[model samples]
Target: MNNKFGLSNEYTLAKVLQIKHYTRTLFSFKTTRPSKFRFKPGEFVMIGLILRGKFIFRAYSICSPTWHNALEFYSIKVPNGPFTSFLQKITTDSSIIIKTKSTGTLILDSLTPGKRLFLLCTGTGIAPFISIISDPETYIKYNEVIVVLTCRFSQELRYFNYKIKQLLKQPHIESHAKNKLRFYLSTTQEPYPYSGRITWLIKSGTLIADLNTYTLNKRDRFMICGSQQMILDVVNLLKSIGYIEGTINNPQDFVYEKAFVN
Candidate 1:
């Protein structure tokens, strides 16, 4: 049953704005904006539908930043996903319910200033990191910004690689990013140019080799967004190395968010 507002009680059909294929079944969408809606760079919102007279919802991070009028989302077409099975078929102008408020703690505002910023993401979890990298303020606050993306294979990195290439070409960030933005893509399950899980890379001391950098120290800020186990592991490693969890008011050495449950 659709809400009386002709949408979900907490969200509304914002309209499918755009769809682009990355790999086999993975696709991304941009939707119509909700005038009353507002969110920070790394926040997330529930997106789904009411089906069989029942409401089904799933949390998805907003790939678009608050500056844009429209909401953007990058989703995986799970084989029989309750929502994506239907969502993937949608095209421009199709309606999609979206919540009014976007919320999450994996934002840059939750971390204290540091000389370097490391954003570690896996699969779709890269969504929020995309927003932070695009924001100009990120460059202003930190001297270095490294985005380490771990995926099952290289094809899955195509979409974001294309996007990062485009962002680096932009005049506003091109020159400024010399000492700021960098992308380090890795694949574990399938063969690719870069291989190995991020955890292994860290343990083997190859992460810095890949980035050609020094060791992680208190002067480094970290944001982990990925699978539950991945988050816990990375968080534990950071803490063991002297980093601390942070918040908006009590910004510290690190921040984290689980991309999704398996």
Candidate 2:
């Protein structure tokens, strides 16, 4: 199928390898990777399908690690979303289009070396971090890796919880993640052990208290992903503590990216 942008040569056709639905509004799928496709962990690429003869593409963060044989994506099913409404219906062997180039700011290379790495995310924002944490380089670079995931309901966190467990069981990754990895889960609308937005937790010092470790400082690095409002709140909180924004050219204390364009 030809892309609506008329750049067919810039797109690669890939077949869906597997699909798993976690909830009515959430699902994940894996697709065959092109031999020439190469992307760093925590990057995103455009993906879509032809609908009524017109191609519809959306930016999606790749959830699988760079070493993985197939590309994986975790997505939300927006009721009337242009791409998701049809994307949620795709099955194994379904044909989809993946843009040749992948790029994003939420990458390990964008941050300076630090002792501890914190990955803060909400909703599908956990996608990029999934790839980051799964990569062996993450564990080798930092002494501690903490992933804070917050969602409206407990069910929304199931997929990540399961994925982390599976990743821990892997022979190659198990050693690095065993004592170094920490997963913190919280829910806002639903009752959970940890409840409330992460910004509030940081403000109240409860997050630091619960972790029972050193406070945020130059020795620590942070990566954030989520909604615009959430990102704004977290960024403000980090800035107040003297954390600076980072990029590929300017390595700093923290880096972030939007889970989806709003």
RMSD in angstroms, all models? Answer: 2.3, 1.8
How do all models score by TM-score?
A: 0.91, 0.95
lDDT for each of the candidates?
0.81, 0.89
Clash statistics: count for each candidate: 1, 0
Off by over 4 Å in 1: 1-10, 258-262
Report the C-alpha displacement of residue 199, candidate 1, in angstroms. 1.2
Give lDDT tens digits, candidate 1, residues 1-262.
Answer: 3457466356666777789988877788888887788887888998776577666778888877566787888888989977888878887757767777778888888887789999998888898887787778888899999999999978888878877886787677667677678878999888876788777778788888878889877799988888788888888888877888998899999998743544
The candidate that wins on lDDT is 2
Report the lDDT of model 1 for residue 172: 73
Clashing pairs in 1: 16-94
Residue-level lDDT tens digits of model 2 in 30-94 = 99998789999899999978898787888899999898889999999998988898899998858
